[model samples]
Target: MGEIRQRFTDEFKEQTVRYIQEQTKTIPQIAEELSIPAGTLQRWMSTHRKFENEPLLDREAIRQKDKQIHDQELEIEDLKEEIAILKKAMHIFSKERN
Candidate 1:
């Protein structure tokens, strides 16, 4: 009888790819840890060889990048506000002197 197929998520694949690329252990070791057959992991890596060079971003990495962008935007806004306030204070001081 043929073995039943299993579906893995993009995140899982990404993580697995990342793990494999890390080279901390052999493919068999990682496959054992992930509860997948060694051949299956080998096939996945081979099938996605193109992406191995330019790794597919997993959800967590994308989220962290988004959060970084948001934080930078907030910081820019705060700096702009501080600049505006300084300008106002300078204008007021100049008017009082004049």
Candidate 2:
């Protein structure tokens, strides 16, 4: 008899990580259930964490940036409305004079 080979996909890896994080099961327990070695699973988790890139902007930084952008957009809209009002006033005044 020949040994069978197994293939794991990206989704499988992600699901395993999620299970490890979210479930109360021990690493060995999960490994046994998945038919992987405990050490290999541990290495997989370490690799996943190590490869995760620290975002250039963290969550708080992103929130601040979004707020700044929203404020700038509001200011621009206000300026545009002011310009329209000024143009209307000038048109009315010129019409009165002529």
Worst 10 residues of 1 by lDDT: 48-57
Q: Per-residue lDDT tens digits of candidate 2, residues 1-98?
A: 99887777867776677667665577899889988989878877876543343343357878998999999999999999999999999998888452
Candidate 2 residues lying further than 4 Å off, grouped into runs, are: 50-98
Estimate, for each residue in 1-98, the C-alpha lDDT of model 1 and write its tens digit: 99899999877776777678766477898888889999988887876544444443478878998999999999999999999999999998888552
Off by over 4 Å in 1: 1-56, 96-98
How much is the lDDT of residue 72 in candidate 2? 100
- What is the TM-score of each predicted model, taking all chains together? 0.42, 0.42
Best by lDDT: 1
List of clashing residue pairs for candidate 2: none
Per-model C-alpha lDDT, please?
Answer: 0.80, 0.77
Task: Score residue 19 of candidate 1 by CA lDDT.
Answer: 70
